[model samples]
Target: MFQLDPELESFRNDARKVAERAFAAKAAYWDEEEIYPMENLKLMAELGYLGITIPEEYGGSGAPVVQGTIMLEEIARVCFNTALIAQGAINGPSRAITVLGSEEQKKRWLPGCVRGENIFGIGISEPGAGSAMTDMITSATPDGKYVVLNGQKCFCTGGHVATHIMVFARWGKTQGPRGIGSIVVEKGTPGFEIGHPGPKMGGRGVAEVELFFDHCRVPVENLIMAGDPDSTRSFKRLMSSFGPERVGNAAMCLGVAQGAYELARSYSLERKQFGKPICEFQGIQWKIADMATQIHAARLMIYRAATNLVDGFPDPLEAAYAKLYANEMVQRVTNEALQIHGHYGFTREFPLERMVRDSRGFSLGGGTTEILRNTIAAMVYGRAFDQRAGS
Candidate 1:
């Protein structure tokens, strides 16, 4: 077993205790109401759970990526909604700010983020483009001291409530990924309209929405990274900081499956059937064993991907492997968990059905499993494989 070290295990235990005590009881409320967890964010902020990865100077604990993931996994075991919030607080969008943002930019934004006062979201996938990053047509045209944005972003995971956003846009009239870059858009900026919230099957509390930047103008200093019209280097550098998003996503999946397994285990021991507890049956026992074994494999892969890093970031290849395996592994483990509960699993009265729905989104959110396979193949071959027509 590739288990956590003593210090890390203790850290994990602390986070688990907080998660089990604080978030578990409220999990159902967030899901059933389908409302944003404002209280959950405040509580995490108060406990310093929201900013473990941010530097101490920025009002964070400056914890390593592994530790931040511990918090995400623990929160996810009880409440996937809150876990997503913490995911952004510690990883994903936060990394982009720290890794690529200028000192002035970090100073202006990161402290509020660490304090949970500011929520940051990412806007990359647009209506015409998702995995085909190069096909995006969102434009960012430079003016005297501002850049005018003219495009829309869809499936924006946190756009509805985010205090600030980083939207990828084409920097010039040029085509392809080489001209792709990103700029920050604060909420309530004129010409930047957030469309109505689009409810999702799982991860209900946080709403996804479409963002329209109709000649939206933001300061030139807000340009986080500018695309080099000549090379794909700028876009690639921006994505490298996104490793935490993929890894944290895997951790959430791991925790969700772990929660399901725990529930099934308890149920098997208590529910009497065929003259004894269901756990006594070899068939049920085998299912339990399989779930645990598979979850363990996924956990090991995620941990390695998170812990072994270059420049404090998980490598793209490692993240693709962990995300893909964990994404697929979550589906199997949670489904089998639902199967163990039989009829009750299908009902809304229990959390099994909810867990299943939540697990399904993991594969689709960060990157589709199909897209990840393509990423993996390219890495393995040490060359970019074009998926375009007539290449």
Candidate 2:
């Protein structure tokens, strides 16, 4: 049931070749300079990776969610930064537009995104509103034919390069989730600009900068779900569309974990200890065993989430669980991998250190593990969580 189709397998092989080439050329530079891989990104565009999940009508491959996850996992195994960029730029916005955008919006936005002409970014997490969407201070006021947006969006990936961003803000409504609405804002808008890009310990090649929108005007037609401001239905719709993005994140995390496990397993066999290969040692073998077990479980969870998503009945809590498990799983696996390498992993000479740093970011990105736990508990217990009410 989880097997790849022949056509998808062919695509995966092609993507693997592209990922291998990227690994050979940009892997070292990405880890060393901590910079974005624009050259590799250009190559990805040429290779059609940027549009793997988009429809053929929109200049994309129209690959299913499972295939998309496979591509992300394969690329991430070689270069985590590239995987992050592909997943963030291509998967998130492409899926969002495919699921939520109007026909006109789809025609206007998806072709460019799939063609690599329009870089895309997601603007949901805010400075104070992370994990709690209700706390976002960003507001939108209705104008004659547009909405005036004013707010700060922090930790926006593709911040410096995105040609368009899906901005979420409270549109002067009193309710929490009901007031939230999303608009597509193009770059170079009068009041739209990015703050200084923040340095990150991992996934360094992808820019995470703060977006400031001061009286930015967006056409009402750009709204993904224009509706009454008193209903949570719109936000729910957005979340439904966002399911694939979360699944992509889980896939990337699984790739990182699998990569680290492979590295550590190889090193254990090659590196010598007091006697035979280190793999002969019980401790090293045990570590490798645990790493493999955890990664296997992570992969299964991610695939299950992806399958559920494709069926149009995704459980957000399951996606969150997959993301949470995979994120924490990668961190552990990478750390063990680094430990297997001893001092060599500590230096910049090997990719292990970079993998460790990259894996750490998984825990914090997407939906954080801590917050996802709450979401899981809520789903299992069937109760709304109210921090204020102490539920």
The 0-to-1 C-alpha lDDT of every candidate, in the order given, reads: 0.88, 0.81
Q: How accurate is candidate 1 locally (lDDT)?
A: 0.88
Provide C-alpha RMSD values for all models, in order. 1.2, 1.8
Superposed Cα deviation of residue 283, candidate 2 (Å): 0.7
lDDT tens string, model 2, 1-391? 4666688789778777878866646776876786888777777778788887788988888766778788899899899878877896556866788877789988998888776788888888898888786778788888999989999998998678888888888876556777777888898988998888788788888879899999999989888765347788777777676667778888988888887788889888899978789999899989999999999898888878877764353468778888888888888898999999999999988788888888887777667778788878988999977754465
How do all models score by TM-score?
A: 0.98, 0.95
Q: Across residues 104-206, which tens digit of lDDT does each residue of candidate 1 receive?
A: 9989888898788889889898888887867899999989999999998998876788988898888877777797888999999899999998878998888
Count clashes in each candidate, considering only residues at least 3 apart in sequence or on different chains: 0, 0
Candidate 2 minimal-lDDT segment of 10 residues: 306-315
lDDT of 2: 0.81
Candidate 2: stretches off by over 4 Å:
310-313, 389-391
